[model samples]
Target: MRVYPEQLARQLNPLTPCYLIFGDDPWLVETSKAQICAAAKQQGFEEKVQLTQETGFNWHELQQEWQAMSLFASRRIIELTLPQAKPGTEGSQTLQSLLQQPNPDMLLIIQGPKLASEQTNSKWFKSLDSQGVYVPCITPEGPQFQRWLDARIKHFGLRLQADARAMLFALYEGNLLAADQAMQLLQLLSPEQPIGADELGHYFEDQSRFSVFQLTDALLGNKQDKAQHMLAQLHGEGTAMPILLWSLFKELTLLLQLKSAQAQGTGLNSLWSKHRIWDKRKPLYQAALERLTLPQIEHMLATASKLELMLKQQGVEDWTALSHLCLLFDPKAHKHLAHIELY
Candidate 1:
């Protein structure tokens, strides 16, 4: 029973005894939970109990509290927050056991950070999904962010000039929380005010964020545009050039190992196992292997060495060199790199 946030207004499973909401975006996760809670309140589930998983959390307390609610014949919603989204062995057993004792009077809501692919298959997670509604709230990316921004603007009861909207997209592209806060400020300052491009600078600061892992993953997965944009964002955020170079160099070294091994009649699985590559990340490596040859990978590694040497000797951070190095991952962009002066 998986339900998306957008479909909650009409297709919300109000009759379910449990709801599991999880995501990296707090706004989306909180919004979905509030909607479910409101629906539960309408169905006489007026009593609410909130529990946050902290250090030395007692799993037994949950069972005891539910029993207390059942004993009083009172409908209740137990809102449990697992910050790390991890339930150890005992906690896992406790949740599974609770599923066996279905209480019509109790509505359980478990909210947490996004679960990894492997975490979703746990016994407790399976049990909860089998009997409850699972809503995964994910942050929008690329053009999806544009739609989300438009919807959010409408929801805030404000209109934006075309250039003003684009400016917000540029300023808060990767950071949703900051974007939401910016919207709140705008709504508070002048409800229903039509924001102009010039007003955007007065009201908001640049809050875009990108991680090195995101850029590397995008490059390996052949998402050239996203990787390019993330690189620019990282540079703008003042990420150390040495750190960025090291990450790219690491990926290049790994790819070189794979390409060299595969060329010498070695199986990819053996190399992957030796490298400790996670199953989910194997596809990204495979994409890189298919796109690049042994010589090309080796050339990129040599290029990285030159950039590292140049940075240490001259103390000049050459972002163009880094961009050219990244762009080489894309066969189409490889030719374009010749035009850029690399150090």
Candidate 2:
């Protein structure tokens, strides 16, 4: 009943009736949730009903939705997002009842923040364990992060020099989302180019010509005007929009994580060590963390994701989408623009 995040992809074919994915790492949690949803869709679970544990949320609605038939969709996926992982007495009874009579027409997905040891051993959890799959999404740290980075780079069909690997590890050690984004940017900026410390440093830290890395740092520092200029420079250089969007969204994701950690009382020094942030870059992260709240950072990320989808799926103009995303970080742009639309 217990499965690792990586293993869930292969396990999706003979889809289980229920899935319980819990973890603290937002990146990992989101990745696993997306993969499961994708697999469900591939298996013809087209209709999705999402339920979140918010104040005034009626738990009975879940049962009603489960029992209802969709006129269009043959099968459906019911997603319950328990942000706090505390399914109350009513929720627990509902879960127990659902498991007692598993639905064949709907796939139930329970997602939440990490669970405590005691909570995991509860009767409700045991019911999930016996009947479905439980996946724990933990962020890798230390050497584990190193391996994750290496694998991620290779997965992107790219190779990195040894020193470049170390440099990337130092820059994006604890943050998988950023590391992955960095790789994607690299692929776009220099397709088929070897990844080395110099290659990474050229864009990330050095005085290279206007580059994606520089734009990322500018966004992190919340230098709106500077970001706009660099974005213009990159666009002028014929840089691809997907790569630019990837870099911006990646930085926003890291900022959101750091902001969340700081809000949760994690010290700057501890974060630095945990994330292997270097001396020069610490101030940028610190400033961004202080300037942006978790909600604002999340909103930026959501907006960037929307732009990416628009460019890829809806065939929107690449420069238009990238320009709109750049505006999200620019104060001046905000004053001029009426409002940003998100999909």
TM-score of each: 0.75, 0.59
Tell me how far the alpha carbon of residue 265 in candidate 2 is from the true structure, in angstroms, after superposition: 37
Winning candidate number (TM-score)? 1
What C-alpha lDDT does candidate 1 achieve relative to the native structure? 0.84
Which candidate has the top score in lDDT?
1
**Per-residue lDDT for 62-119 in model 2, tens only?**
8898888888958999999998888888988888888677678799999998889877
Candidate 1 structure quality by residue, lDDT tens digits, 1-343: 7887877667454568788898987778888888988888788788888998899999889989777745456589899998988988988998899979978888889999888877789999999989988888887776888988888898898788999998899788767888988998999987877889898898776687778987899999888777888898899888999999889988999898888889899999899889989997999999999988777787778888889989999887888778888888986765666345455
User: Residue 324 CA error for candidate 2 (Å)?
Assistant: 45
Candidate 1 least-lDDT 10 residues: 334-343
Runs in model 1 lying further than 4 Å from the true structure:
11-15, 70-74, 188-196, 217-229, 235-243, 254-296, 306-324, 327-343
